[model samples]
Target chain A: MPTTTRQWLLNGHPRGRGIEIDNDFRLVEAELPDPGQGEMLLKTHYLGFDPAQKGWMENIADYVAPMNIGDVMRGSGIAEVVASNGGRFAVGDMVFGTTGWTEYLVTDGKELTRVETELSPTAVLSVLGTTGLTAYCGLFKVGKPVAGDTVLVSGAAGATGSIVGQLAKIAGCRVVGIAGGKDKCDWLVREAGYDAAIDYKAGGVKEQIRELCPRGVDVIYDNVGGKILNDMLACIATGARVVICGGISRYETGSLPAGPENYFNLVFRRGTMAGFIVLDWASEFPGIRKRLEGFVKGGSLKYQEDIQHGFENAPQTLQRLFTGQNRGKQMLKL
Target chain B: MPTTTRQWLLNGHPRGRGIEIDNDFRLVEAELPDPGQGEMLLKTHYLGFDPAQKGWMENIADYVAPMNIGDVMRGSGIAEVVASNGGRFAVGDMVFGTTGWTEYLVTDGKELTRVETELSPTAVLSVLGTTGLTAYCGLFKVGKPVAGDTVLVSGAAGATGSIVGQLAKIAGCRVVGIAGGKDKCDWLVREAGYDAAIDYKAGGVKEQIRELCPRGVDVIYDNVGGKILNDMLACIATGARVVICGGISRYETGSLPAGPENYFNLVFRRGTMAGFIVLDWASEFPGIRKRLEGFVKGGSLKYQEDIQHGFENAPQTLQRLFTGQNRGKQMLKL
Candidate 1:
């Protein structure tokens, strides 16, 4: 077993919008953790990257508390138990928890959930994990997609949004995806079974949405908020449901000039725009896991993961999500 | 019966934000119309003025069609049936309908409703008309206040807003009102039975809201959108509900520099912001009228009206709504 561990620590907060690699985060070596009573040592196998991590690095409290400087960069990852000391977990058992940006961790078994060995780790992290639950609950609970409803998803190529589109389709709704670049857009329609996809990078998103959704969008699963959300507001059907999953567009830009300008359309359309954190639905997650797994087993739901290798590249992998370089669910296999 | 009827015609649509009285409207004399088969000739007694009328005058179509350049300015009013030809109404019957800015209107009785003789005509327009229905429906259906909820209302001195504050109070909520000046603020707490009132004209509306609602506002009935709405977004409690009733702040601005800036807080707060047209609840208005009447009869609800005289002042009366000059529901007696 390894005697030394590697970690990425929050060096400093990005005083401005964009985060600088070396300035905001630090890499260091530490002694391998010794498990205390009811504790276990975990070796990270794969680390997860998300746009929300950008918010965590900021000096403001959100759904989760802000990360103070010098703390381990808090995150989610798949880890394998290396040592056990009278805990719920045993040595060699694979687990999923907030293992963070570290190669090793010691936990009291409180935050950990044992991984089902039946599915691949990536599958557990992607379709059968929090991402999948977010997509399902946000669609059904907030968006309320009815059969034959026109469901539009922004950031449709991202981890949660990609699953949201498929879930909407499974509910018998016509799915439209808004993605950056032709590659992601084409993959959405061809590989992901989306009814249509709009390349937001090419511009004219408003016109494309209007043309494709002539009767107006019944539900909008929005991951990318800002001007795009503003544009969709103009084209929503009467009594439309807008589920705000994330705001990746403004995650890096600390402040923007404006919010949704056409939000007044909510009154004209008699619509509801709601937002929620997936953790709020934790009590219902067990049911969600079974349903998502059923879809996956039935060959109805498909997912993609862009797994990068190396614990050394964790910071860069996170940056890839902001730049729209990492495709699918951005993951780093250590 | 008068042979000549005075009317206010839409002279032109305001190309800019501000509506010029003489430039956008023209007073003229027209011959009184005779009732045809299934029609009735109604004489206007009191015409109602609303912020929504400003939207109606704009070239853009909203809940209703835009007023044509030469058409009589559309409005709601209490009228008396003078003559009827095989219609649902008889002579001397007091009715309420869209009597517009004309002294006499020939209608097919389909648009008219017989007023209750027990209530004052102004009461029919203020607390028992569409305005009352808007307040009751918006407060109960959209705001969904619970006991102990901190319900904050913007434009609380205005017609719909004043009623919303009272209704929220009746729903067992801690109601705080935001009005323009000291007089209106004093009336809100003293007469309207608000828990507290914020004088927005004093400035620092955001700070005042935070001070008044330390635990954060649970429900917001917003009539003035833009900066004030933006400010309230920052002070919302977790799982808040923001009901969009009107956007009077932007009505005269035409185009604004931005919308709400901190709307993303909706996700962090797990909030829902919704909007609706009161006409959409037309099917339930009968129940709402009974409920409102009960409140008024039980002395749990109070209302104020700024009654202006002369049909010739129709243009000026409508302007009072935009200027914050009207103390309560702005209306004109012919």
Candidate 2:
């Protein structure tokens, strides 16, 4: 590793349509410092990029505080403890947390989760990290799908939605997926075990969903919001649940489209729509991680990552999330 | 007792703005219903009218099946059991249920909820019956307002809204009300004990709600939908719960105005929006009714009924809900 560490700093708040690396972020280098007592030097291995990062970089009112200019662009990643002073972590113990877009970080064991189990650390970041936990809790806890119910997953070829579809199937549900293109749609049914896949780009989303589900969707795992959300809302069954995890389609592209025009069906159908962040389920992370590990080891889970090499490409890679260019979990591999 | 009874039959499916009696209904006089074994004859004393009645009358997808043409219009009412063949009901018992828009009904003692308290039957229709139970359950059960929370209630001067406001206030939350007129606004703060009230007809509803709930609203009990629901959605606090009971503003008026455009705030704030109907909570009605009775007896609950005289005015009285002309529970006394 170099004596000087490189980190991308948030240079300017992202506005409508521009989130390019040169326009919104600055890469800065600083000399590495030794760890103090009760502190450790951590080296980034895998940088986890999520659609929510766009909201954090923007000046808009969002779930989290906007990343201030000149601050390290906020993110989550898997890292290895390089040097430590008497504490829970030792040198080379892998851990994952929000370590930001940095080559290395010094921490006092705060917000870090050990990458336990013999499974590959890269797999942990892709499927068992925030992505898997989010899919697990949002589906079962919020969506609450039961056997024989129809579950609709938007952005179904993506990281979280892929896991959600498989889980829904495991729970004895009829899973339907909505994707932008034919390839992703094919992947949803062929690889992810979704019962059916609707290519939303073909239009007629409402009619397609209606014909596929027939009885209307029992739960909607909405990742890509905007018009797709409205389509699903229009066809949701009575006592349905919309588990809102991400709105990647319009997160920071430009203006947010209106909320679902058919949301009142929730009233007529006696349904619920809830939004959640994975951080709120930290207490159950261990159980969630273990279950995800079992799925992986048992070959029941299919995982993929759009690995963008080098920390320097972090900001550029983040743009793919909103542009429908990312196939799965978009990660920065150091 | 009269040898013949008059009832309003759904003559045509109401569409657009034609909710007038002569356009959509016909008054029919039928021979009085005679009770058989395990049955009773219910004399409708007060016919309850609600905005949802329009949905029931139309051939539309709704919470309940639309009333068929030529069938007696579906409605709830306060009634007295005039004759009983045995089983649960006795003569002279005042009860409230789905007794329809008729002067008399015969039932097998199935759905009637006994109005046993000393409060007037009119008060029972307004506060101790479905109206009050809806407010209680939708607020406490679904909205789940915590102490010191800020609750905003749309239609705060109407029957369900009036009760929701007081109940939220009693739960140790700062209650803000949104009503149409200055008189209704004044009544919300004065009689309903709402901490603040915004007169929506005066405009700047979003601005007023922002000013009143500077910390952001924690729970929103929405009786009206459309623009005001959108406004509340834009400014709700983290973990907020939006309780959707009725959309009086659009239930009977032409097409449903598009669903609230600001609903994405639920994602940004990690909040929830649920739509519920009172019929789902029938098992818990006894508890809700008892709690509301205590509120009334202790003088904490104040209720008003916009009582229109005579059965002939039932169709016209039902219009008041959609027009915002009814101050409280809209009931037609026969």
Scored by TM against the true chain B, the candidates give 0.96, 0.95
Instruction: For candidate 2, give the docking quality class from DockQ.
Output: medium
Using all chains and alpha carbons, the TM-scores for the candidates as numbered come to 0.97, 0.92
* lDDT agreement with native, every candidate: 0.87, 0.85
Best by DockQ: 1
Residues B165-250 of candidate 2 have per-residue lDDT tens digits of: 99988899999999988998988888789999999999999999899999999999998888889998988998899998877667
Q: lDDT by residue for model 1 over B1-334, one digit each (tens)?
A: 6767888999877644877898989999988767789988888999998887877788674567768998999899999988888879889999987888899888897977888735567877888887888888888988899999999999998898899999998989999999988999999999999999999889999999999999999999999898889989999999999999888887777553256867888888999999989998888866777788888889998888899999888998898887888987889999
Candidate 2 residues lying further than 4 Å off, grouped into runs, are: A34-43, A80-94, A105-109, B1-3, B16-18, B30-43, B80-95, B104-110, B113-115
**Model 1: lDDT of residue B103:** 91
lDDT of 2 by residue, A40-69 (tens): 889999998887777788768555666789
Which residue runs does candidate 1 get wrong by more than 4 Å?
A: A1-3, B1-4
Q: Count the backbone clashes (under 3 Å) in each candidate.
A: 0, 0
